[model samples]
Target: MSFFSEFREFAVKGNVVDLAVGVIIGGAFGKIVDSLVGDVIMPVIGKIVGGLDFSDYFIPLAGQTATTLAEAKKAGAVLAYGSFLSVLLNFIILAFVIFLMIKQINRLKRETPAPAPSAPPPTPEDVVLLREIRDALKR
Candidate 1:
């Protein structure tokens, strides 16, 4: 077979299609998670932690000391721990969501009814007659 045909066959496979769809969905899901962390969860956390903005929290190194994180970056190297914290939170939330989804899927699988057992095939008439003859002889 030609390489193009082989490639087409591989691309048309169910697993490959499923994987592509999963990747697209996962990208969208990541955006949702990012928004959840940055817009919703982080704000609440910041409020609880004395209204501190995580993005603005950084350690200035090398250059002149600046008040804000952006200023510090402009001046010199700044360790952006706050941004790291936010990203870490986003990862944790995503992992938790995936875990819950998998758990639910497993639960659904467990709840589904198993297939019914099939009935055994009927015995042949010849076999039945032979068995009857053997029984008569024993009697």
Candidate 2:
């Protein structure tokens, strides 16, 4: 087969298509989680912790006296631990959500009973005749 045909066959497979769709959905889901952590959760946490913005909490490594993380980076090197904390929180939330979803899916799967076993097919006529002949010869 030609290379294009082979490529087409591989790309059109069910698993490949499913993986592509999963990647697209995962990207969108990551964005939602990022927004939740950055905009909603982080702000609430900051408010609870004496109204300090977590994203601005950084250690200056190059003696730069910048106040915000963005400004610090522009001035010199800095360790942005607060940004890391937000990302870590995002990961935890995403993991928890996925765990819940998987748990629910597993529960649904368990609720569905398996199909009952089918009865065996009847013996063929030829086999039955052969058996009768063997029985007669033994008699």
**The best candidate in terms of TM-score:** 1
lDDT of 1 by residue, 19-73 (tens): 9999999999999999999999999999998998887888777765788887888
Q: Show how many residue pairs clash in every candidate, following the order shown.
A: 0, 0
Single out the weakest 10-residue window by summed lDDT for candidate 1: 58-67
Q: Listing every candidate in turn, what is its Cα RMSD in Å to the true structure after a full C-alpha superposition?
A: 1.8, 2.6
- What TM-scores do the predictions have? 0.89, 0.83
Q: Which candidate leads the pack in lDDT?
A: 2
Q: TM-score of model 1 relative to the true fold?
A: 0.89
The superposed Cα distance between candidate 1 and the true structure at residue 98, in angstroms, equals: 0.3
Clashing pairs in 1: none
